[model samples]
Target: MNHWLMKTEPDELGIDDFAHEPQRDFMWDGVRNYQARNFMRSMQPGDHVVLYHSSCKHIGTAGIVKVTRAAYADPEQFNPDSAYYDPKSSATEPRWDAVDLCFVDKFPRIIPLSELKTLSALADCALVRKGNRLSVMPLSANEYKAILATTNR
Candidate 1:
């Protein structure tokens, strides 16, 4: 299965919110960037995801999420009153998409961005790259493991 990291603003949606939500799954929506939309379109059910909390005091992968549903038109994009509404996206020809993510577990503590930036192996990680802003991006198995390695350290 493909691996990925999906970012969410903590104030908007965070690991704590997922843990409290019924079934711990939420429809990831409102992505506006073309690259982020394209990445969602490539996802599949049963894939793994690193749920990262971004634009917060501690930006990092805070939990795990299993892709429960693949690509679908982002409902937010079609709502006229929605802050993420895109007038250009039609029901028949959507310009945005999102996936369903079921929260698996929350790490005891966050693996902070500062820490990620210091990891030699993660030097090539897009998550830590300068000006990197895609909300969703692919991750390799080794990268997944390397991040998880922090949980036990």
Candidate 2:
């Protein structure tokens, strides 16, 4: 299965939120970036994902989640009240897509971004590269393995 990394603010929707409701399918939505949206569209059910927490005090890879559903139109884009809503988007022709992710595991401790940058396996990863802010990005098998290895699991 393919591997990927998706970033989210801990306060918005983080590892803990998924851990609390492990069985629920969490809709990963509100991605406004075209590249990020394309990445989501490429995901398939059963693919693994790295759950990264950013824009918070402790920024890092917090846990593992797996795609439980493939990409579909983002419901938030149709809601006028949602901050992610787009008037140009229509139900028949969606401009954004979202996927469903289910919790897999929560790391004992966060694997900090500083440490990730030092890993040779992730040296070329967009996540570790400077100025790369796309929320959803693909991960090489080596990079995924290396990140999980840091958890000692």
Q: Which structure among the candidates has the greatest lDDT? A: 2
| Total clashes in model 2, counting residue pairs 3 or more apart in sequence or in different chains | 0
TM-score of each: 0.94, 0.98
Tens digit per residue, CA lDDT, model 1, 6-107: 888889988888787738558889888989888889999999888899878988879888899999988999899999999998999999997888877888
In model 2, where is the ten-residue run with the lowest total lDDT?
A: 144-153
Pick the TM-score winner.
Answer: 2
True lDDT of residue 4, candidate 2:
98
Off by over 4 Å in 1: none
Report the C-alpha lDDT of model 2 over 1-153, residue by residue, as the tens digit: 999999999999999999999999999889999999988999999999999999999999999999999999999999999999999999999999989999999999999999999899999899998998989999999999999999984
**Which whole-number lDDT from 0 to 100 does residue 151 have in model 1?**
78
